[model samples]
Target: MLDANLKKQLDTYLQNIVSPIELSVSGDNSPKSKELLELATEISGLSGNISLREAAAGRTPSMSVAPAGQAPRVSFAGIPMGHEFTSLVLALLQAGGHPSKASPELQEQIRNLEGQFHFETYISLSCQNCPDVVQALNLMATLNPNISHVMIDGALFQEEVNQRQVMAVPAVYLNGEHFGQGRMSLEEIVGKLDTGAAARKAAALDDKAPYDVLIVGGGPAGAAAAIYAARKGIRTGLVAERFGGQVMDTVGIENFISVPYTEGPKLAASLEQHVKEYGVDIITDQRAAGIRRGELIEVPLASGAALKSKAVILATGARWRELKVPGEAEYRTKGVAYCPHCDGPFFKGKRVAVVGGGNSGIEAAIDLAGIVEHVTVLEFADSLRADEVLQRKANSMGNIDIIMSAQTTEVLGDGSKVVGMQYTDRVSGESKRLEVAGIFVQIGLVPNTEFLQGSEVELTRFGEVVIDNRGATSMAGVFAAGDATTVPYKQIIISMGAGATAALGAFDHLIRAGS
Candidate 1:
């Protein structure tokens, strides 16, 4: 249910629509179904041009928006709540004859498609990236008769999620094949569709010609390393599953040293552009499966290709550590999330919990306080480890409540979504429960180093690659930087500096070895 102010705003938005829109709501007697039906009824009542009808229940709760003349092919298999609320509104607007925001080229491509294309995008209500992919597929489906799209909420369909091995949100299936995951651009989706390729080919690797310096990971650190290596005018190569790494998931980044303000995607674009300006052989959409340390390091990719490099810079970054508690995994994306920026909007006006007292957790609380109704921070330690400045800011927020020495025991959820969290106060040895819609786990980070399990490269107890002052690892001709390594801090600026140092170290090593 929307508040008075939001309902008024929606009423104003719907007043401009001229075309008639039909909303078909179909579901069983489930709670999710009742919630969706109530919301749909309320939304349809706001506009005279819109109408709501009941459809036969199928496998799951579903809703569809049909334009005046077009058949109903665009459907959502779950309640489009949270950040996806906008998606539902936009679907209604589009069904009411509003034009799509897709580029002319993309519109033409969708219009001229010959073969039938069906897209099933599995998404969480909290994912910030899902909206773009879902909207793109919906637009294509609405524009073309042969194109059909379904947005499936992964949390509500755990069996399907497990069967598909979907470990992440925004997992897309084009014609029943896993197309890709994460935030994808409309143009990228169009390109993939037009090319009819589920996976993009990496840059050709020649075993005979080994690269002088090969950089792994494509975050800020790896990008900087590639730029530095390319400046030497040597054969440099960079491989990454994605270009932006953690930076892509971030939203507001005000502390990038000199930059006054910038978002994550903008910074990621700039990094990619800067890397492209040089002669760096950048290979994307490929993950390094393993590394063979020898005279020439051999890095095998998941795609069955191998790359040989005289020197390697491991800039692989870190990911948010999971709570690993009961209901945490089950309610992931349903209410349990990692990135506040990515999923915070979905919990607007709802009470949420932040599981951590460090800088990230405090920051998350501070950020969510402005959007959500309330924020409760649970710290495992007796005191928060975040800087005084962050703690001060968090304390200033009236909506934030910090609980120290709190051990999260479980993430309680309904069969379909999260409803509350259970924790224990370490000092009192008493358990407690907090009724909240979402939980953001920001305990810490885990380095992306599982692929290097048997490699000669030394790693710390925490699995971070051990590096010297110059970013050189224990093994010769091997270097590492960024959060993946034993770096003091995991900031973007520091990672860039580390990457540069590693590149210089690699160049110096090559020079000495050649002499």
Candidate 2:
């Protein structure tokens, strides 16, 4: 566990000096330098940015990706608490924005392997801007054999730019293809790698023959598909950008039927374990670029690996559609939180808010009532959309209060932490502020099917993978299930059942194809 004083001191450091551009600011350390940023730089990778280290040591610190670029310049490991996390990588990404020649390894691989090495580092010359971006990219290129970069001047890159037909400084062109123009955010770049990786994989797989079963998502659905099919005597393989799917973010998953109170991480871990136990080959951190036609399915991986399978099951689950309010993304751990189960324990006896009015929201508020000192539920609807049971439970909680027709207007906080929130009453257009330690978003979930870029798998109007009674999809030898599928319920029990059903269907398809 991070010492309380240390965490607080780190919080102070984050608010005053941390910015994605800090790129952890200067690998060179000089004690004579009297700047918070320099101090930040010195201590940024203190733990070697190793989340695994803390976990192995039995201390809980939730860390996601560093602020920028492909690899770890500062290795923003551990739960990215504040601006320090951002500073760690921004410097590296800033370095990416140059004609700065790289080592032979970078020059040979990333410069042309996938196509072109195009990148735009968004920054001003300030220490807060360009330095981190450049350094982060340098670090990232070390891991990926095929990635190189060039920088664009912040002042000149902004001049009368022709984003189209290519006359731009801060933009990258990949084999004459424009990657992006204007200021590139971290999320934007992450999305870019996703497609870029997928594109390369799809192209490579275009030549392969299909297999018995090809699972599109590497989440609960795909993992289950691989396990069940392998168990039932069928050849199967799973592809996804990241293994364990969003379930990895889930600290614990108690609602997942059969298992009444399991950590989400534990559940996902066990699922991955079970799949491997059945001899199901699980590809971690790979995406399905595309699925080509054949007697079976020819699925491509973002890593340029091609896989073939007879039937494909899209177990791609759902992701939380963010509020997109300002501080929501910026100050995530610094007071802005998502999962009640994950971050709730940290705020014991503190005030918090839950967004939305449906059963999910009401249930969350009701659950939070017991833990936090105060619980405020902001609902966009006139009345709660929760079922009677949840509504009754929420109404019964003294600490929980509901505000109808309320919508989040702005997430206001110190640059490094969230201290309050602003909302507008739908009826009167009146705005108000609420002070809370965290806000839970129970608004909705989005199915993960972006990989179906060119496939025939049908999706519902709501973006779910369409499936028949047995969890079969519109395409022959393909199956669908879990939240991503057209299954009405997104409950865990239903997802498991659907996963089983699809596995069975894939097994049947395999048997018939073999016979």
C-alpha local distance difference test of each model: 0.84, 0.59
Instruction: Indicate which candidate wins on TM-score.
Output: 1
Clashes in model 1: which pairs?
Answer: none
TM per candidate comes to 0.70, 0.56
Looking at model 1, report the run of 10 residues with the lowest lDDT sum.
197-206
List residue ranges in candidate 1 displaced over 4 A: 1-115, 118-181, 184-209
Q: What tens-digit string does per-residue lDDT give for candidate 2 at 314-348?
A: 78798887788867877664566555644454455
The digit string of per-residue lDDT tens for model 1 on 1-515 reads 77898889889878767799888888888999998888889999898898888887454688988886567878899999865777777788777877776557568877877788888998877676677688878888878889888898877877887677564678889899988876776656776767742233333443336899999999999999999999989899998877888888776788899898986767887998899889788776678898996667888888667789999999999998999999998887677888886667667688999999998899999988988999999999999999999999999989999999999999998877789999998999999999998899999889999998888888888999999998999888989999999998899999999999999999999899992
lDDT, candidate 1, residue 89? 77
